[model samples]
Target: MFDVGSGVSANWLRVVIALVCGGILVDIARHGVGPLPFGFAVTLAVACVFIPASPAPLLLICVAAAALTATVDSPFAPGVLVLLPLVHLLHLSCAIAALLPRRARIALAALRGPLRRAAVTQAVVWLMVLVGALVPVGRTPMILELAGLLSIAGIAVVVIVLDRAR
Candidate 1:
């Protein structure tokens, strides 16, 4: 195992990056031009912190905390909104960064160990469930489907490239 001290520091960095990026994007979206829903900020934050680490239950706790604060009209919501896009961007970036030829970093995470693999599976399932429950099916446009398909294809291609690299 890696050194405990180093690991904590690394996790702290991840959390800090997520908070800063998430806050900036959410703020800009809310005040600069196109305003996103408050929940988007929460989603972005969770995605930023958890996406790279297998999305544990603790991440869900953080999400829940954010949601609760929003429902109660927490003052931090405004600042948090600015960073929303950054958080999401970071999450996507992490997934993409691991792209080595064909296999995506996510695929590598899946192949790493049982715990890591299970976390990915669970995170995917949880994401689907959360999206289905929170976002109305009718709200998403046809473009969403296209985006989803493209994402899957991209990941698959990455995996293929990784396999070839090996």
Candidate 2:
């Protein structure tokens, strides 16, 4: 709500990060993660609001996602699908919040580029998810995991190169 007299601050974006963190937790909880670990993640998520520029926010969501993966036996679980976007949302919001001061006024046009990049990245991630879903039920081969990791690194490199070219 960045109205004329009540312009939105970067803090509002941080709040969105926190809310996405909450969504990650709720999805994790639905998979039966215990309160102790959930509570730990809560602390990290809260810290994200105050320190969006740091690695805390990413750590918070990754930990929750890891817990969710461990507790569930299937990669095809709906929770995993649900969390994919939440993690991205938390990451994108925190990144935007980190770039500006708390009192800075944000322009919606400024968000268009980031949001579009996020969408493209998300589409790529979903492609990976589709590939993952096709894997047989059993131990994942070490080579497949390595390939996935390399693919991610490659994507990052390409993104950096493309952005720099513009």
Candidate 3:
């Protein structure tokens, strides 16, 4: 009785992403950068199953999750930083899975371009973070911190330009 067309609308996809992101934030609040609770993880899994019905929500959710995780967790936790891209991929996979038609046929071929772009974006972001980490900003003076803020602003501008060029 489940109709994929009805469930896979853009609005529904947004709702699903919002729910999943909320669940992730809750888990982070409860456990910090530690392991998520089984129940919450299961809930997220269920939410992901419906992601393909509206693919745009995945971007919003990923951005939100990355922002939240970066702000709430210690920057020294490289493991957590690395996991962000992996988590985004998992979400992407779940969204793609939701695209299966009523006949259970998956149009995965259509996703090749999008997936490639996403991978490239993730790689660039990870590379930037890695490079930034290599800089010895430890115990820097207030002036250095201010300069760092300016550098971050410059990076943001570059990202925006690159995104527009794409």
Candidate 4:
């Protein structure tokens, strides 16, 4: 997984680009050429190319943003500015998680080996994501958004820490 600090700094420009392009496409689709659904489609199209290959933390962040955008009233919904920070936070988280190797390695010299540690780490990551999603921070949409982002961040952090341990 990537480092929390490095992920944020490394992906700063990319995030900004995503925000600008996503927002513009959304706006144009929502109010001008097509509509919200159109904007969402465009956003998804762009993300398809970028998200999958990105670091895990970034992927989660992009997914969260897409999910949020998908459900909220429309593309860049009037009141969804709150999503900006939430997306930023999520991006940071995903970047961190992606730094881990595809195959895990054990850290302790006496441990069973790499395979076992990797499986354990993967399971732990899934559990963390589940817990993060289920835990409610507040009732507002913004609060919910933040909680989701934080949950993703937690998962990313776990991956980074685990990878570091190896």
Candidate 5:
């Protein structure tokens, strides 16, 4: 149950987030590596707007978009790189919006810590991706495999540590 006083504000915030995310998704679709890659992103954004409490659909959409970006054989355009962090933010915003109760007085202050943590985590992840992109590496299959494995391991370790800390 929400602290009734803030329900309207909270719902408005949620709608705004959904709209911004949807807009970003549309932009991504417009400039995406391929038309199919971001098609789900826009669709999911609309779904999220209608059903803000269900965060999983938007999460899956984000994952799919990221996967498509990774697998697409496109040039490393600077614009795409800039769009990456915004996409991450949209995902974070959607998650936060979903958690908000429809009839609660959500203290904006209460969100500060979680938002800051999420931002920090996103920044770290983006930095890693940027570094990987900037560093020119041989596209040998063996090296690519090794790098993928290491990345997975690193992500697992980070997840475990974060869980423990929580």
Candidate 6:
């Protein structure tokens, strides 16, 4: 329920975070990660729903990443596109939810800045994914390794420029 002066409830954010967690679990399962790791990741994801401020979300993402690497043949497997946004959403929602009062009401207008930043971040992630997809799958070349480092540097530069511009 929304209260006066706000457009949404904090509980709604919690729901969004939970949905993100579910999305991640689905992605992990689709990758055919073993039952044991998947179960543990599921537990972490569930716990993250309650303690959104905790490191469990990070752990969940890590588990998913490991599973993807182990089961998928390509580092740039198309499924990564799905995982990227899910984890990003999980992080963004959790950060916002953790900063608000338990029963707080929030206006979308108030979230504009953070939401805008998240959009930019996602754009950068998508660009990286595209670049990764273009690379050959066999043994990584030194040039590719250098390109990776440069791309990471480029991303850092973009973040800094954007932050300063704001």
TM-score of every model versus the real structure: 0.26, 0.75, 0.46, 0.23, 0.59, 0.78
lDDT of 4 by residue, 47-123 (tens): 63255245433443454455555556643364244445444433433343244333333233322464365557666
TM-score of 3: 0.46
Per-residue lDDT tens digits of candidate 2, residues 34-133? 8888888888888888889998887987787789878988777889889888988988998889998888887667788999999999999999999877
Q: Which pairs clash inside model 6?
A: none
* Candidate No. with top lDDT: 6
Higher-ranked by lDDT: 1 or 3: 3
Cα-based lDDT for every prediction: 0.48, 0.85, 0.57, 0.49, 0.65, 0.86
List model 1 lDDT by residue over 116-154, tens digit each.
Answer: 654675568557655755665466788877998999999
Error of 3 at 98 (Å): 3.8
Off by over 4 Å in 2: 1-7, 135-166
* Candidates arranged by TM-score, highest first: 6, 2, 5, 3, 1, 4
Ranking by lDDT: 6, 2, 5, 3, 4, 1
Evaluate model 5: give its lDDT. 0.65
Per residue, candidate 6 scores C-alpha lDDT tens digits across 94-157 of 8888888887888878888988999999999889878877767798999879998999999999
- Candidate 2 clashing pairs, residues 3+ apart or interchain: none
Model 6 segments beyond 4 Å from truth? 1-4, 136-166
Encode model 3's per-residue lDDT on 1-166: one tens digit a residue.
5444433333433454555555555544544433444344445544554545554345445544555565555664644564466567657655655554434532335567878988898989888888878777667788978998999999999999999999
Query: lDDT: which is higher, 3 or 5?
Result: 5
Q: What is the lDDT of residue 16 in candidate 2?
A: 89
Q: In every candidate, how many clashes are there?
A: 21, 0, 1, 12, 3, 0
